[model samples]
Target: MVGLHLDDIDQRILAELSVDARLSLVTLANRVHLSRNAVKQRMERMERDGVIEGYTLRRGSGPSRRVTAIMLVYRADRMRGAGVVAELARIPEVVRCDILSGEFDLLVTVVAESMDRVGEIWEHVSALPDVENTVTSVSLSRPIDRP
Candidate 1:
């Protein structure tokens, strides 16, 4: 199938939505300096093109802080229908999952309020069918997300 061409205005709208998906159409219109109707039309087109799918709230606060834990999940074999990797993707605790190229095939970064929650994930996910092994690493601090 052919893809839609993105002009400068389309790119601007896409970038703004990426940074702050919660922005209302009126707010986005004002920020982009386009008429509300015009902005609405552009946003609608983007949505139809599968560019803007949905909006989400940025959650969490307090000293508890969000924790990022990396998990290495090994499978019985690589071609067992994604095996543990697909199973891990179903977990809400898991935020990011990637197919690694090494001794392990799945690398997952889980976000939670405490280490206990992270451990719970390891216990449950590692015990699933076709899982060979799991190695975990807890992040001390995030240097990139914040200044």
Candidate 2:
């Protein structure tokens, strides 16, 4: 199934899984209006087709538990090269990075164990060859975090 296509049920399954990967087969089937066996078969097919990769646990963030920060990065080469992004990918604390259309070239979200770790990540990112400048802001309170 090199050119495998996903239908509505398949899309729904993926959507539900994205929200909660630990959902039981029966629960997933109920949400998608399918039998448990059918849901299992579809999920298995999706895994074989490379549509469904391995699941990961998303840790929770609370006071004195985790530190989250957003770094706005400006690269010397702008968006011409992927070297900076490749380097950022190696840092496990860097959770999300998005290319923007404003003054900042990339918006990086880092969730580290402590403020000192965030500082270390900031310094590492600042010292990168292609990085021109970076502005970082630590999250005070996550009032509305969807993910």
Candidate 3:
């Protein structure tokens, strides 16, 4: 909706929420120099207008770094139903999954604490009923990352 209009206050509210969604309405109101009720009304309007769709969690620095891997999955039946997707969702390590338009049917991104854990997830994916085969590659270094 390119035509959607957002005033300066709405922009400031979005900026603050992007930095820390946990900020209370009172704190946000103070930062935006508006009454608590005013801020609440603006936020509610943004939500209703779909300017603020939802909030997401950002991963914090943990003691152990996570290993990342990409798995290219080949399905036997070409994902006839939602069963395959449902099963993949059950695996927490699977961070992202996308349907591809090539030899592979699905591309899945997985993150785990160690190589062993990544391997375990790979094994689990390989054993899924709909999965015929999977080609996996572990990420050694990320030269560029956005978001």
> In candidate 3, what are the lDDT values of residues 81-123, reduced to their tens digit?
6556656655656666788887998998887767998988888
For each candidate, what TM-score against the reference? 0.56, 0.59, 0.57
Best by TM-score: 2
**Model 3 quality (TM-score):** 0.57
Candidate 3 residue 61 C-alpha distance from true site, Å: 11
* Candidate 2 or 1, higher TM-score: 2
Error of 1 at 112 (Å): 1.0
**Which candidate leads the pack in lDDT?**
2
User: Residue 140 deviation, candidate 1, in Å?
Assistant: 0.4
Summarize candidate 2's per-residue lDDT along 49-114 as a digit string, tens digits: 877778997666743467889999999998899889878755657767789998999999887878
Candidate 1 residue-wise lDDT at 143 = 75
lDDT-sorted candidate list, best first = 2, 3, 1
Error of 2 at 105 (Å): 0.2
**What lDDT would each prediction earn against the true structure?**
0.74, 0.84, 0.80
